[model samples]
Target: MQRGLSGQYEIGSVVGQEEVRAFVPAPLPPDPLPDLAGERGRLHEQALLACGRLDAITALLPEPDLFLYAYVRKEALVSSQIEGTQSSLSDLLLFELEETPGVPFDDVVEVSNYIAALEHGLGRLREGFPLSNRLLREIHERLLARGRGAERQPGSLRRTQNWIGGTRPGNAHFVPPPPQRVESQMADLERFLHDDQQPFSALIKAALAHVQFETIHPFLDGNGRMGRLLIALILHEDRVLHQPLLYLSLYFKQNREEYYRLLDATRREGDWEAWLDFFLEGVLTTANGAVETAHRLLDVFREDREQVEGTGRSAANALRVFHALGTRPVASINDLAERSGVAYPTASRAVEALEGLGILREITGRRRDRVFAYWRYIAVLNEGAEPL
Candidate 1:
């Protein structure tokens, strides 16, 4: 369906130096999202089913927030990694503990900024804020607040031309709409988002919104990470999921080439169908993986608890510490003492008991200020979060 130039290109000056053609993406909710019949229909059903399974897992958890907190951090790491950050899940956990050690400060800050940005977006949504350009700017501000790209206009749209890949717009893989047209393009997008007359599924809308946002390249920095975050945010806002759980960063990180190619194809060939198929498949895969990870985490917690129970009198204190570990996954004895509301010695004893049961592993091996990890629990969550 090669509809030709997805949007009009405007002749613009590059830093007032030379003329360049900047691509302005047409506003979204795309007139018609290729028809949702036959194979596409089946993919949609599978995606919905997978989402159902994911939501059900949240219901099964006694304290889904404990899982949600850790899960969101994992997403933050993966999403940031897609933008070339080297922070790992363990680094994020350790960073949150105020322990830097071998972690790169800049990378960890970027990851932390991601967490803050996501939390900000979710908080605003909970307060009944519409997912508009305003919220996007708010999130973008937090994202670049204290990281490497902080100087590149944190919350504002780019005033000068920005290009993706290569050295400059002339040799770049893609050049987004010039700065002057960004506001109007974004306003059109906001209308499409609020337009109820548009006939499109929430999932389809999210997929299209993501690509459109990326194409717009609205911000000077953090557009890629923000575009990816928009997927989960849109779904959460649309009530497609009770919690912001589905993350496709790992899938995108794994299929990096194809992911970029599909986006390019969509812009160059109007091959929305192919992109939609890939997006739905990512939804299906990511949702199912999240469900399985939830189950495995629960199993680890249950099995560890049962082992702790076998320790008799020490079981009660150890169980408390174990529960604390379930929330943080990694902690020092002092942290356990604070989180479990136990004395330092008691927390140490409980940690020792759990360690004896092979439920916790001491990571530092230092007698003083030792840190322990709920190895199995962390392993389950760290499955796809390894540095890419």
Candidate 2:
């Protein structure tokens, strides 16, 4: 339904020269509410069911955090890639272990900062912090804490006009609300998030909130990453899922064109249902993918453990090293020895046995301080995580 422009445009000057009409979005609980009837309703229902299944699978895992550890890094990589970073999952893991000379330092750092930002947000939420503008600023602060965007007022809202695509606001693809209006606009969004009286379900609420955040473009830099983070935060805050397993960056990255188009339609036509359809489908697709990935990882773990157990007298130490590698798929021999509570020589032998069995491979060629990786484990998690 072409319900007309969702918000009004205010005449504003940019770069102290050109005149640009900046958008000021209306507060949330979108008027007429979203049409969650018929097919849209079914999509929402199916997405919720998929979420339930995803959540349930975690309970069966011996260590859900193992999957979360890799998955979170994967989300960080893909989400950063969406914003033009070329960092891969291996680069991130390698960076986490120790800096490698050949890695894209700045790009990987940006991705690393994303992981930090996410962990900080989830940690605070776990400590009972309200998901408000304050938290968003804090997350944004960490997001650019040490990366390429560090000088862009990491934690501060923009104080000047910022444009989306073009060189100047006048020719930009979309100009967000001017700086002066950011605080109030963001406050309105917070109210909608906290408004219990609103009839939107958690899934619907997350979808609406994400578009609003992106449309607002509250911050000068990192707005794209922040908008994506808002979806996971809302779902987690609403207790829709016990763990932070559902991430839509891969889906959004895959459907990049349609994703942006629907967002534009929601702003121009007040067509929330269209965006909701896409959002719910993303939820279903991502949730199903996560569940599938979890099962695949479990199979790898079971199969590898079986192989380790069949190694005769060397089985005990090798299993210990394997468990440690399960915790972190990439590790040095020294690190594995310490983590698995085995002596250095014992850990080295265990790593050698696992390597001989094709269970682990040495990532670094140097004979000293070399790192080993659980190839299959990383391979499974690396799917769809390639940098674009």
Candidate 3:
């Protein structure tokens, strides 16, 4: 349903410009509410079922947190990529290992901060903190803690006008709410988030909140990343998923053009139903994809363990090192030794054994301080994570 102009454009002024129209989005739950009926209703049900499946599949894993760790990094990479970062899943893993030789330091740092920000948010939520503006500020602070975005007023809401695309606010594709309107608008969003009187499901609420956050563009920087993160946070906070496993970054990245178009459509045409359709489809696709990846990782772990068992004499120690690599796919020989509680030589020989079996590969290509990657494991996690 075209509700017509979701919000009003207020007259504002920016540097080098005498006048600008900054959009202030209307409060959540959209007027007349979103039409989650007919085909849209069916899609919503299917998406919810898919999310349920994704949540349950974690029970089948040997260690759900291990899967969560890898899954979160993949999400961080893809989400950051949408914002024009060139970091890959491998680059993020390598940076975490402190082995950043040829890595794009700035890009990888940005991705790394995304991971930190997400972890911080999850931690706070786990401690029973409300998902309010304060929590968002904390997450944003960590997101821009270091690297290129360090000085963009990390934790605070923007006090100046910000635009998306184009050189200035005058010609930008979209100008978000002016500084004065941000707090009130965000407060409205927060009320909607905590309103149990809402008639929609958690999934629908998440979908709507994400658009509201992005349109508000409350933060000076990291708004895109924050908006995406908001989806996962909402789902987790509302107990829609048992874990933070469903991420739409890969879906959004793959459908980059359509994603942006839907967002703009919602603001310009007030076609909330259309954006909801696209968002539901993304949920279904991303949830199903995550389930598939979890199964593949399980298969790899099982088959590789069986292969190591065949080594006989050295199988015990080699298994230990492999187990450590399973937890952290990228590690050095010393890291393996310490993590596996084996001597340096034993860890070295174990690594060589795994290498011989074609299970692990040396990534650093250096004699000293060489880093090894659980290639197959990393490969499974790297799907659709290539930098754009």
Give RMSD to native, each candidate. Answer: 1.9, 1.8, 1.8
Collision count for each candidate, in order: 0, 0, 0
In candidate 3, stretches whose alpha carbon ends up further than 4 angstroms from where it belongs are: 1-4
List pairs with backbone clashes in candidate 2.
Answer: none
> 1 or 3, which is superior by TM-score?
3
Model 2 bad stretches (over 4 Å): 1-4
lDDT of 2 at 173: 89
Residue 180 local lDDT, model 1? 87
Q: Clash number for model 2?
A: 0
Name the TM-score of candidate 2: 0.98
lDDT string for model 2 (1-388, tens) is 1124688888766575877788777889888777898988888899999999998988999978899898899999999999999987778888898787677899999999998999999999999999999999999999999969999999999998898898888788898888888999999999999999998889999998999999999887999999989999999999998788899999999999999999899888889888998899899999999999999999999999999999999899999999998889989888899999999999999999999999988877888878888999999999999878
Q: In angstroms, how far off is 91's CA in candidate 2?
A: 0.7
User: What does the lDDT read for residue 293 in candidate 1?
Assistant: 85
lDDT of 3 by residue, 1-388 (tens): 1123788888876557457688888898988798888999999999999999999998888978779989999999999999999887778888999847898899999999999999999999999999999999999999999998899999999998899999888889998888989999999999999999999999999999999999999998999999999999999998888789999999999999999999999899889999999999999989989999999998999999999999999999999999998788999999999999999999999999999999998887788888899999988899899888
Error of 2 at 135 (Å): 0.8
TM-score of 3: 0.97
